[model samples]
Target: MKYQTKIIEKPADTLTPVGVYLRIRDQFPESLLLESSDYNSDKNSFTFIVAGLLENFKIDKGVLSVNHQKKSIENTETVKNALKDFIAQIHVRQPDKTKQFNGLYGYTGFEAVKYFEDIRFESKPQKDAIPELNYGFYRFIVAINHFNDNMIILENIPDGETSQIESFKNLVTAQKVPQFHFKANNDETS
Candidate 1:
């Protein structure tokens, strides 16, 4: 059976990081998905978080078709261990300087309180400031997903608004999806 890959890019204003993460976790089966990254830095750590969520779905049946780099870490035990290590490391590290730290940490529970001092939200902003902040967030998301060739990026088109499910569908239809193929061992395909 052919699988449907729906790349949902939640609106920065509307959906919190936890909400988006949960939605993605609940919707897809573990066996059907793969999070991609090269073990370069903490920047790609969110991929592991997503993979951890998928691992929850793989408790009974095992995950299949992992991109080779993550093949060893595909099982539930490994994913759980990775997540535990990640959290421990984040805690031990005191301040995570990665972009994911800024985005995901800001919206999560305790981190939200700890990092509240750094937040710059304005209840009553000047007209110019509003546009600038929106542009900044948009640019940030674009940059984060730039090197993620395995994941499909659904951009919020027409500039300032959040991306909708219809927008995701339209983007997928427009051939904006990633062109890379999953490789296992030496095998490759388009």
Candidate 2:
């Protein structure tokens, strides 16, 4: 249930991003996937988007487990408040910047549209979240071309500021998936 973001060396082409996106799709099986224009474009840009209920991320009754982050919605009022806050946050960030903004941007949405609204309006709270919850796990990754002199700036999305999203940031920052970790001995140098 741990969501990770790896900043590997950018591939020579869009093959790596496409591969990653496909791998995620295969893993999720029933996700609402979205590939940025740059992903399908002929340009050498690597941008991919994935959103849907994978195996681990789900919410049942008043309980929710998003990438292993479990929490109860408290009550109907609490759920409403949380949903309001979540929607507000989503609106603050433009959908198009999912890739350009960089790093894993995870959210519970169906498409790039009014997903939470439908949840808030359609589902009637019955001592817990009615109809059970199966929201998409939106994910975004940044492929670094020149990893040497560049740093990932964390200023775009407001999600990083909240304690709720601290785990997401921690996964991306502390536990980065190292792609270029090879040791070279002095004697072995060419």
lDDT of 1 by residue, 21-138 (tens): 3444433323112234553554552332222111111111122112212323333356456434433432111122233322211112221221224343434433433111000111
Model 2 per-residue lDDT tens digits across residues 62-128: 4665545776655556555654444444323344433454433334433212323433434444562
In model 1, which residue pairs have backbone atoms overlapping below 3 Å?
none
Candidate lDDT (C-alpha), each? 0.28, 0.39
Against the true structure, whose lDDT is highest?
2
**TM-scores of all models?**
0.19, 0.31
RMSD of candidates 1 onward, in order:
21.4, 14.3
Alpha carbon lDDT at 184, candidate 1: 78
